[model samples]
Structures are given as structure tokens and as C-alpha cells.
Target: MAAFTATCCGRALKMVVFLARLVFQLLAVYAVVLLLVYVCQRSLQYFPDKNHPGDPKESAAPSMREVELRTEDGLTLNAWFAAPVKRDGKIVVMYHGNAGHIGHRAVKAQHFIDKGMGVLLVEYRGFGGNIGSPSEQGLYKDGRAALSFLEKQEYANAQLVIYGESIGSGVATQMAYEIQPRYLILEAPFSSAAAVAKKRYFFLPVDWLMKDRFDNIDKIGGIKTNLLIVHGDEDSVIPIELAQMLYEQANHPKEFITINGGHHNDLYDHHAGHVVTEWLEKQIAAEEPAVKPEE
Candidate 1:
């Protein structure tokens, strides 16, 4: 009987070891699959040329001078600078959203130029025919590089206005901490990238695992510029309530405009450009003009 019991115990131990090894293999496979999915989603924007300019007529507006910028990582970023017939040392550096490149922002940029302000439309690291992939850190570097490039030009002394739309808001907020633009504008922004990810992938525990935080809510309060937030009440992607939450966190001298009947992609549909231009004009007009010494 003792010999029989010993054999049974050995058999149980072997079974436990086999089950452990099988579980380990399953986990290893799961990890690799998860990694592959992440890499694919992160790189989906760079593959194929889907972001090209769909409307050629967008170029019919006043042409903007093309500007090329280099990030700290040596990746080239493309930009378009539309200066007034004569610049008065005021520039608006606009950052495009995650979906399309700067080509989609031509109408918005023209409105700024029409308002007597130089507009700089910057492409993120991987978007708009730029080299490398788009990440939170890369975008911050790209935005700073654009600002540095602008600082070297004739409008170096111009008041800098930073504008960001959609995912670009996070980049804009990070740059605000670094460069402290004279004015900051965010359109259809989210509270945080993680927050949006959580909403989209509620089935999985992605909020904690996501390497890119893009936490704009944390960075917005530190910005020392006049903040202007515009959002569409009918936004289907990011709720308008979150936009209000972000606006409320801002300090004094901040404004919020709700684009009537607008959606996430149609910010310009309900007079967004006109509303933004009008607000910018009033803000710029309110500031005390810089005193220049007569030669």
C-alpha cells in the first residue's frame, strides 16, 4: 500500500508541472499577440497615403510659404506659414489633429491670415508626409521645433498663438508648458488620451497599459496664456461635457464657445472659423500694443 501511495503522489506532481508549463506558454503567446496589435494601431496612420489633400481648391486661397522643420530626433516635419501682406510681429502656430495632415487645415489657416495674423500650420512627426512615427513625446518636440523655427524668422518678435485640434490638444498643451505662447486655442479636445482610450476599449484594461498618456487636463492649468476652447455640442466622439470640464479647469481670462450643430469632424461647419477668428481678434486687440522706439 505504501508503494502504491508514493506512485500516485508522483503522478500528481507530474500533472501539476505539465499544467504550469502549458499556462506559461499560453501567457507568452498572449503577450506577443497584444504587442503586435499595439504596434499595428500605432503605425496605422503612417501606412498608405490616405491623408492626402482631397480638395485641390483648398490651395486656391492665399498661398502659404512652405516651411520645413527638424525635430530634436532629426525627423523632418512639414509646415505652411501664411504671413499677412505685411506682418506686424504676430504669429499663430497651429497643430493639426491625429487623423489627417495639415492639408485639411488650409481653410482654418487662411482665416487666421485674413485676420491679419501669420499662421503656421505644423505637421506632427509622422503625419503630413513627415518622417518617423507619431508619439506624445515626438509631437511635443515637433511643436517646439516649429516654434523655434518661427523665432528665427522676421516674425520672431511676433506674438505667438498656439492652436490645437482633436488629438493635437495634448501636443499643444505640452508645448504651452515649454514655450508659453501668447494665446492658446483648443478645438474639440479631450480631457486626456487615456480617458478616450478607456471609453473606446472598455472591454480591456488599456487605460493603465497605454504608454502614451497625453494628459492635457494636468497640463492645462500650468499654461499662463489666454485659453480659448471651442467644442461642438453634437460631438459624437468626445463628449461636450468633457470639453466643459477642461475649460473649467483653466484659469481666468479663458473663453468657451460651443459650435452650433457641429460634430467632431465638422468644427468648421457651424462658423467655427469665424467664431475663433472673432475671439482671437478681440483678445489680440485687447492686449496693450508693444512700444517700439523710433529710430
Candidate 2:
């Protein structure tokens, strides 16, 4: 009995040692993964297309001209600009999702232009044949450059509508909070890049590993402008729950719309443009001064 007990004890100790080594190895591998994630998070997050988005004239938006916007960082980015139709007189500054360049957005942009709203399709650094790399601060500089161009055009904050799509919502949120545009619209926006990364990389320590937080949830409260949050009920990319969370935290004078079967990129096909146009017009009318009958 004593000999048998000794053998069993030895076996148990060896098993424990093996398990400890395995756990240690896994932890080491995970740490390496985390390091790699931290370094390459932006590359994974921003999927830009160096290929031109195609010509605006080809996209049926003949008024949009290829223009150069100078950033505070001294980088001149290629952007699309169009003055609003005289009837509408509203300038819409659009920051597109982090994917194919601004040209991919010309179709929806034309919808706004058709409504007589001027649109500025701002392209970021390192996107659409523009020079430089993309980062949180770099994108902000690009946004500032867009606004500066508008400022030079004599457009007031009240005449401006700031729009962001997907990741671009981060840029839009920051700009709206800073400038207080007439309306601020976000489509399929994540609460923050860290939150989205955590969703996709549940196994990793994303909150700490992510360098660009985007942190839209934290900043939404600071936005006092008229806010519009749109999400698709079936949005698989950035779940509607995230949009709901954002809307819940937003200030009043805000609106939230859920497309019945909207996905990340197809909201436009689901008549999202119509929704935006209707809401913008309603908000504008409500804010317009009442016309009293002449005495």
C-alpha cells in the first residue's frame, strides 16, 4: 500500500507540472498577441482604399468637384466639394466610413445634393490617393481642414450639417461637439473603437491593447447639437445594441431610427437617405421662427 501511494503521488505531481507549463505557454502566447494587436490595431481598424472612389461625374453628382483641403498638419488632402442648391442653402459635410474612398459615397452624397444641400466629401490622410498616414489625431486634422474650407466659404455653423458613417462617426462626433453644427448624424457608429475591438476580439485584452479608443460614448453627451442616430435592426457588423447604448446617453432634441433589416453598408438602400432628408427638414422647420400673421 505504501509503495502504491508513493507512485500515485509522483504521477499527480507530474500532471500538475505539465498543466502549469501549458498554462504558462498559453499566457506567453497571449501576451505576444496582445502586443501585436496594440501595434497593428489601427491597420486593422481603418480599411482605406488607395484606389480613387471613381469620378463624381460618373456617380451622377456632376456638381461635386475634386478639391484639395489643407490640414493644420500641412498635408493637402484630395476632397470633393459642392455648394448646396440655392433653395436649400444647407452645407452638408460628410465623413465616410473607413473603407473605399469618398467616391464610394458619391451616390448617397448626390441624394443630399439633390435636396439642394451642399456636401463636402472629406477624405482622410492615407486614403484615396492622399498623402500621409491615418490616426485618431490625423483624422481630426482632416476634419478641421474640411471645416476650415467651409469657414472660408462663408458658411456659418447653423448652415452646416455634419454627417459620419461607421468609423467616421467618431470623427463627426468630435467635430459636432467642437463646432455645434445645425445637425449631427451618425450611421452604424460604434460606441468606441475599443468597444468594437472587444466585441470581435473577446479573447484578447482589447480595452488596454487598443490605442485608438474613438470613445464616442464618452463624447456623445458633450454634443448639444441636434443629434440623429440611425441603426439597422439586423446590423451584424456593429450591433444595434451599441447604437441603442449611444442614443440612450445622447442629449435631448435627438432622434433614433432602426431600419427593419438594415446592415452595416446597405442602410442607404433601405431608404436611409429619405429618412435623413425628412428628419433634417422637420428639424429645420421646427427651429425656424414662427411667421405671425401681419396685424
Q: Which candidate number would show the highest TM-score if scored against the true structure?
A: 2
Candidate closest to the true structure, highest lDDT: 2
Give me the displacement of residue 218 in model 1, in angstroms: 1.0
Per-candidate alpha-carbon RMSD to the true structure: 5.6, 1.6
Question: What is the C-alpha lDDT profile of model 2 across 1-295, one tens digit per residue?
Answer: 9999999999999999999999999999988988887888788888889876667777767789988899998999999999977733888899999789998898889888888889999999999999888999999999999999988878788898999999899999999989988799998998888878778889987766777788899999988888998999998889889988889899988999998889999999999999998998888789879999999
Residue 167 CA displacement from its true place in model 2, Å: 0.5
Per-prediction TM-score to the true structure, in the order listed: 0.81, 0.95
Q: For model 2, how many clashes?
A: 1
**Model 1 spans with C-alpha error above 4 angstroms:** 1-33, 44-60, 154-158, 289-295
Q: How many backbone clashes does candidate 1 have?
A: 1
Encode model 1's per-residue lDDT on 1-295: one tens digit a residue. 9999999999999999999999999989878866765766466322323453433335734478677887788877667777655556468788878777777788888888776777888877667666677777878888888887877775553378888888888888888877777789999998887777777767546754677778888988888888999999898888888788888888878999998899998888789999998998888778867788999
Ten-residue segment with the worst summed lDDT in candidate 1?
A: 45-54
lDDT of each: 0.79, 0.89
Worst 10 residues of 2 by lDDT: 51-60
Per-model clash counts, in order, read: 1, 1
